[model samples]
Target: MPLSSRLPILLACVVALGGCAGHPKGVMSPVAVSNKTGGSKVDMLVVTSRVPSDDPATLFTGERSPHPYLTDISVSIPSDSKRKAGTVQWPKKLPPNPDTDFAVTRVQQLKSVDQGRTWFRAHVVGGHALVFVHGFNNRYEDSVFRFAQIIHDSGAKVTPILFTWPSRASLFDYNYDKESTNYSRVAFEQTLRTLANDPNVKDITVMAHSMGTWLAMESLRQMAIRDGRVAPKIDNVILASPDIDVDVFARQWTEMGEKRPKFTIFVSQDDRALAASRFISGDVQRLGAINPADEPYRSKLEQAGITVIDLTKVKGGDSLNHGKFAESPQIVQLIGQRLVTGQTLTDSNVSLGQGVTAVIAGGV
Candidate 1:
């Protein structure tokens, strides 16, 4: 059979096998794996219904839910025997907790304190806290490690916290992943409230990627509505390549009331992934993927007190337009040096290291 024809068969098989397992009774337990070198290993635990249905897949792709969970996860690190270099491994499957009513998964141990050199849970000192929400198809370890690298590379004093939802970790399960993202909203909000209430936490900055942006916005909107304030103790809200309907974002922003973040949105016209997203959504434009050079949404966002960064001309790694957060050193530096410092980069100060035009708010 042709690969195209065989694809459905493979998907059916996966769904059948997944559905065979019964729903877990409670929250999944954390699975811990240790490396002999006393370094760190990454692992993932997933609590999901054994019976796979089209529901999860539908939720991810259809935008039925903005957040999704990776029902399964894996973590790896170098083995002790090969100190110089070897692959990480997991010995056993972590069971789900019978007490809690939700499925859970723990990905891995990040032991790198000096950035991404090695994984270590360093003591979080002072300064504000920056929370990151990863988008669809990301495993827990992937999100944590990437953000760790970004934080380390930026040399920002803020403590970084990652909110990992359950993602199916498959391209086909887009709707399922989106459903998971929606399901994780409450947990995300709880995390925000916890950090915001922390006396040591000076301010809160939330940076969400792709579909996670919906979850982030919804959580903030809910919080603001409940509190009747738009600027709820938070400082910055950065949305990177948000996979949301432009109209929906506008409505959400309006409903968020007073507790809005000092908003910053990053956009790129050449993001192929977003192009695919646009196609999947029937060509409805997304604010995060709009080109500031041409899209009027740039001016609209600026008028609404949201700063938009156009990275279409900026080149870097990750062909899928996924790694822009960590790829552009200049962008990262600007984010750390200015936004984190409670300052916005004006057009004159915004330089991309070339003769290219700087990012001007409202085109100056």
Candidate 2:
């Protein structure tokens, strides 16, 4: 065949290969990933209730009901270079080198957290562990990268574990995400129980974002209902940009009762994301966007024994203002050093560290 005759066939083949490359690569569990920010390799353990997708080549892509399966993975994230909070960046494509783009290096399978605990022991602080539950619109990779960013930014030695639910990973999937979160309640409880029951884990901190807060609270509430008390190992709870309804949150707290972990709720009146969520859900006030300076609202939360950090006044990073607790460098410092370490935070502490004048209601 002449050069002209072969050119069209070669071009067609190249185009087909490129199309296949863009499709889902499928799930690779127990994968090892390198971290560019800290220049280290970290392990990410996943516990999910999502069913296996037909694209079994990829991990956890099915939209079916909660059949609940657990996977442990490791991956490297893009480096911050700036070493500041609220500044995490992800690459558009997976590359050969983590320095170039985020990609998984290795993967291995594990039966349960027993194997994970071995890895967890190395990161524990004073025998403490940190459990993070991610919110709506998150895929497995998105959850892993965000968790790694938070852990790296916090500079805390505590072991970090992520509980990821089946999020449709779409803005239009709000209702689907809500149902998926609710469905994963039992599985989330199991993840907590695994940590709580482990003798190696003496103290634990639970953090949840957006819709994950609802799942975390409901899971704990269910455990409390069954055991008649919250786990003593759970020493602290952090709810960042929680998308729960104010009234529903009050009821959830009531169900869980007292003797719970020290509760910290990060709220911002200017959170446009939560504002949109409110508009979607019948115009009810979502918890994350609540103004702490309000008359009865502040009093109600304080009475419930919850600590509310109002971020309406603080500036820098996250224009939407829905993720300041983890995204804001100043607040991330507060969370990494004080919150996870079990240090009591006050107005002076905020001023001394972040140098921002914040409106903090309900605290010691």
lDDT of 2 by residue, 96-191 (tens): 346634456565445656676765665566777888999877776677767877877777667777888888876656788999888888888878
How good is model 1 by TM-score? 0.67
Candidate 2 whole-model C-alpha lDDT, 0 to 1: 0.71
Residue 208 of model 2, lDDT score: 97
**lDDT of every predicted structure (CA atoms):** 0.58, 0.71
Segments in model 2 whose C-alpha atoms lie over 4 Å from true places: 1-38, 53-58, 62-67, 77-85, 122-125, 315-319, 352-364
Cα misplacement distance, residue 104 of candidate 2 (Å): 2.6
TM-score of 2: 0.83
RMSD each, Å:
10.5, 10.3
- Among these predictions, the greatest lDDT belongs to 2
Error of 2 at 348 (Å): 1.8
**Could you estimate the TM-score for every candidate?**
0.67, 0.83
- CA error at residue 28 for candidate 2, angstroms: 6.6
